[model samples]
Target: MPLGRGYLALAALATTGGLAACGREQQTYCADQNGVVVPDVRCDDGSPGYYYYTGSYGRGRRPGYRLGGGSRIASTDSNGRARAGLPSTGHVSNGHVTSGGFGSSGHGSSGG
Candidate 1:
């Protein structure tokens, strides 16, 4: 027998509900690092990693976490900045580089 429109509507609703339930069964990852909530995922790679909680879309930035060497977890500072071993300059802060040189202003040859 052919199904009635109401029956089809009910079936569709049931299917959607089932799909929603399936989604709910999905996993998520969440972690707290240094007073920062680092979601279960990678901020750079944007992939799911290590843990599940049924509520993670596996997107968005995960604070204190960085994807390095392809799918590896790297440590980050409290400001979410990665720790690197590059040579440090004596005059730089907040991404601005400053230097005292010659023939310009302070702490340089005044062309005497």
Candidate 2:
């Protein structure tokens, strides 16, 4: 028994293969330590169980949900954008959140 070209092509098209669209980007959402997707506000206000989840496979302009991983979107935001003060990159996994985003240990910066 041998595999046909059609079957091979289909398998290749599936999963993380070369056939993936070059101009495709998905929504980089925020999740909790348990990897549960929640409202953007929760992640922004430094609420408990709040963290960023980067499941975007490729780089596309359109914003969409992650095709991989296990997560349930809590709710959609009126504005599709992460609130201010929350870093766009990096994730907090220690179950300790800082309100001022990256490099913030709940301490105010002092510099004149």
Candidate 3:
């Protein structure tokens, strides 16, 4: 026996909705060239060092974010990308971008 078209549609809808549950309300934030959280003004002057960011959905910054669309407004780039050298919005350093940690080289958690 084969599944009905209705069942397939229902399954697809459920899967879409399931992924939507893991989202967060996106808000505008100022960030530097590396995507580090900076004062909101940095993005206002249309300068090079700053850009707009939605803080990556599903990261949970605040509340009341609709499913699907992550941000109300995207960054000011033609391709909708902030820049190539920007930081990863997943970790969310909260303006505390650190470089070169134990995870970088072959270093162990317990010091020798």
Query: Candidate 3: minimum summed lDDT over ten consecutive residues — where?
Result: 103-112
lDDT of each: 0.28, 0.37, 0.39
The C-alpha local distance difference test score for the whole of candidate 2 amounts to 0.37
Please provide, for model 2 over 1-112, each residue's C-alpha lDDT reduced to its tens digit, 9 standing for 90 to 100.
Answer: 9999999888877744533443223334455555544445565554545444433333331223333541222223212123422243334221223223232222211110
**lDDT at residue 83 of model 3 (Cα atoms):** 28
Off-target runs (Cα >4 Å) in candidate 3 are 1-24, 57-112
Flag the better candidate by lDDT, 1 or 2.
2
Error of 2 at 59 (Å): 15
- Runs in model 1 lying further than 4 Å from the true structure: 1-3, 24-27, 33-36, 39-54, 64-112
Q: Which residue pairs in candidate 1 have backbone atoms (N, alpha carbon, C) closer than 3 angstroms, thus clashing?
A: 28-53, 28-54, 29-40
| Collision count for each candidate, in order | 3, 2, 0
Please give the RMSD to the true structure for each candidate, in Å: 21.4, 14.2, 13.7
List the candidate 2 regions with Cα displacement exceeding 4 Å: 1-20, 56-112
Question: Per-residue lDDT of 7-44 in model 1, one digit per residue for the tens?
Answer: 99999999887666543321122233222335333322
Clashes of 1: 3
In order of appearance, the predictions have TM-scores of 0.28, 0.32, 0.35
> Distance (Å) between predicted and true CA of 79, model 3?
9.6
